[model samples]
Target: MTEVAGSSNSNNLLLEQFKDICAVDTEIARRFLTESNWNLEAAVHLYFHANDPEAIQNDDNARNEHEIRRRNVANPRNEAPANQNAVVRRSSESQLDTWGAWFRALLALPFRLAYFSLREIFLFIYALFGGNALAITNPREDLQKFLTAIANYPNSERINWFNGTYNEVLNEAKSSVRFLLVYLHNPSHQSTETFLDKVLFNKIFSDFVRDNNIIMWGTDVRTNEGYKVATSLHELTYPCLSLICLRENRMACVLRINGMHEITPVLTALQTALAENQRFLNAILHERAQRELDNRLRREQEQEYQIALEQDRAKLNERRRLESERQDAERLAREEEENLLIKKQHLAEIRERLRAELTNELAVKGGETIRISVRFPSGAKFDKIFGVDDSLEKLFNSVLVHATCPDDFSLVSSYPRVHLQCAPDWYREFSSVEENFGGTKTFRQAGLENSLVVLVRDNDA
Candidate 1:
């Protein structure tokens, strides 16, 4: 119930505005506004242009067609019959008035030609000065020249004119979604002075226009640009006000108040028209703002998502690197342990073999026995008996069987302190040595006497 009452109040407000703007009865305004889906702007646009007084002179059949359509809506059950009757009536009217219309058009042809000639001239001028595809002259200069003629008087109230050509002002109005108030002034006409003095320069009218944010633009009809617009509008009046607004994606004439008028009526006309159409501008503003906000929000979200994705990917990669390093360390530790076990087992085998060979060599304890003492770095001593003809290899093998012997060592003589190359690889440190520098020499063959003590040195230590 509240929604319906609110809707009713809204409709009533729309009807009042439409009647005031179109200067129609309440019933007429209600009917037009309803036909236009309660859109004041569209409804007002339709009422003015459809029932244009100038249109009534040129093509009155259009008004008849509109009336028929309006009646068709009120009595929908009789629509087909009404359409048939309309078709018959139109056929009769065409047949009866064809010759008269043709003759009238023939008479109007010369006037139309003159009008078209001026229109073409203005179009060429606009192409040059109105920021066309290629502008040849400065539009600001042209507008200034036009405004200079109007502001020639000292006491004149100057309107804040748009500093551009008609084409530029139209484009601006469309872009800004504002009403373009176009005044085409004819200097020779009687109404021009009245319009300028009473309406155009009136404080109330100016204030209303300023408050409504209407773009004021004017040019003399004698000028090429203005002449072009005048011819295009087909207005015969001296002082013409063309109220143009952005409608259906194009700047179109919403209402035109022509000839002489007082300030109040002019202000009322402008106000009603603006009230009828400003909703379109508001809607456009809202839509653009909404689209911008949506785009901004989407961009922000995308940036955040990308940032989060990068952070997660970085964390995952770090974890993988740590896990890989841990696994590698564990593998290396296991390999090192296995290698140590194998080395220990190999050393035990070598010790057992060395003991067996040493026992065999020392068992022959008969001829020319030489006893040598080996002193280790840890102060451990090993006294081994070898035959005087036994090779130094027997001494090294006997030392190896002892648990205190180092894995890699060279024997040094105790009294002489000479490094004896008894080990197989001991000569590797020398650039040149005797051919029999290794363990191939026997203890007696080498100059070693009985009970010679040698020191066992560890190579790594």
Candidate 2:
């Protein structure tokens, strides 16, 4: 029974693999990158492993189990496996559960390790301002082409699928950062536009009104959503406005154009968006400038008041100095007068005793005085330059987040479209797991998807 269950699970896994490789469309992966809110790393992982059989199987099992538990909790017959006579089904289910757990755990290890390694490398490159956007391409075709190109490059090493160098991926990412262009076509003629009967113009008009930005200027036709017969086509273009505004909050207009239609509208639409954003940005800068000007004026007023107070202080000091000098002069005159009076009295006393030998002597000594001035010690000036504050790292991180893109593209980098959120405790766990798997690229090459999640979660925290 166990063997049968194992066979069924294996078959299911194989089928899922086939569908991922063959059946699922590639465009969906690109769409998900923008919609999923996953940073570039996570998006790349999702795109690469979007079709993995094991992932699908696990998701299916989880959903199925939840549904069964919710619906069958009151049914005793369904709850007990022992009461069932279905030996093959019971064995297969048990085998699937046990094997799936082992497989998931084994598969997750390499992914986790790769995540850490790649992020470390990526962060280093980002420090150099050399990171680029992830290009949305047909994975199978693009991967093969990229590999072929790498093989032909002079002094390039062979790309190891299981243990590919992070340098190689970095180079590839830089070179392949192109936007995916989507063009819509008419459903019936496979052309740009067609005349449809009984179409509600109001519906089309309402869609345009809700969308705010209009790509189709001067066209009054509205309510085209419920066409009797409509067709569409897809093509690649350089001016992918939809991709550009993928992360923006504002709604963008979607225009219908046929393959044979002129490229003028596409160019015009992009030009309009550019002009609008430029005007908005300029206005913001102007407002900031005015605010700065007002602040400067206020500072100048404060400085003027300070200068006036300093002048008043100087005048008061001058008056004090003159008064002190006058007081010292008066005191010196009084002392000299008292000394003269004493001298005269002493002379009179000496003259009265004429019989005795009268003698008077005045002694004076020459003396020099030297004065030495010393300055008191203070803490070293500009102390913050040398580890005075432990929060320097935090300050630098804040700067990094807020700094504008430098003029030098070589010094400009985009933040990862995806940011990981995880707890500090999770990081400790990841660190220990990484220690055992260090010094190898086995983790990344094993699977980019799992690696993306594990690595991003660890680093982001």
Name the top TM-score candidate: 1
Q: Which stretches in model 1 have alpha-carbon errors above 4 Å?
A: 1-141, 154-158, 231-236, 316-461
How close to the true structure is residue 150 of candidate 1, measured as C-alpha lDDT? 81
**Each model's lDDT:** 0.66, 0.32
lDDT of 1 at 418: 74
Model 1 score (lDDT): 0.66
Query: Which tens-of-lDDT digit does each residue in 1-461 have in candidate 2?
Result: 01222354554553343223222222333233333342345544553433222232334443443333223222233222332211111112222224553565366556656765887687678856856533334334333543453344332331122122222332332233211122221222212131111111224422432343322111011112111011111212111123122112222222222122123343343344444454543454566679789889999989998999999999999999999999898889888778657654653453343213211322213322111111111211110111221122211222222223111111111132322211122122223223322222221232212212111111222
lDDT of residue 325 for candidate 1:
97
Worst-scoring 10-residue span by lDDT in model 1: 85-94
lDDT top scorer: 1
Candidate 1 contains a number of clashing pairs equal to 0
